[model samples]
Target: MIEGFTSSLAEVNGTRLHYVAGGQGDPVVLLPGWPRTWYQFHKIIPLLAQRYRVIAVDLRGMGDSDSPLPGTTRRPWPAIYTS
Candidate 1:
């Protein structure tokens, strides 16, 4: 919710993932640890946005992202981050 940051939902691996992006320059992805969400970086997101394009994501089963049920097969998730 920072001034310049924009939040969005993306369909990745058949899951709806939530993320916030802002600023410019090289991309910087922020992945929260277990039981956490992108809000964890609320304080620093704006600061880092000053120098880089910051992207904070809410991983599967966390935050605004859709949680996949157990035993379900999913495409590789890392591919979304790598490219």
Candidate 2:
């Protein structure tokens, strides 16, 4: 766990999404690239969190987030990322 960061799971389209959040003020959502987890932002999170609320998310099927079942249709990026 990163210092000063809190981990959480959010339900989106019946899947559990993992994320780490911290700090205050305006919210800043960090989306990682392919094959990467929220931990990728560990170094920058603290710096950004100093002035903004940082939320680093692990995209589905990547980190601790749930993976879609085989044969299921893949959702679009907009739908998957939207709250």
Identify the leading candidate in terms of lDDT: 2
Cand. 1 TM to true fold: 0.85
C-alpha lDDT of residue 35 in model 2: 91
Worst 10 residues of 1 by lDDT: 74-83
Each prediction's RMSD over C-alphas, in Å, is 2.4, 1.3
Model 2, global lDDT: 0.88
lDDT (Cα atoms) of all candidates against the true structure? 0.87, 0.88
TM-score of 2: 0.90
Q: Which residue pairs come into collision in candidate 1?
A: none
Give every collision pair in model 2: none
Poorest stretch of ten by lDDT in candidate 2: 68-77
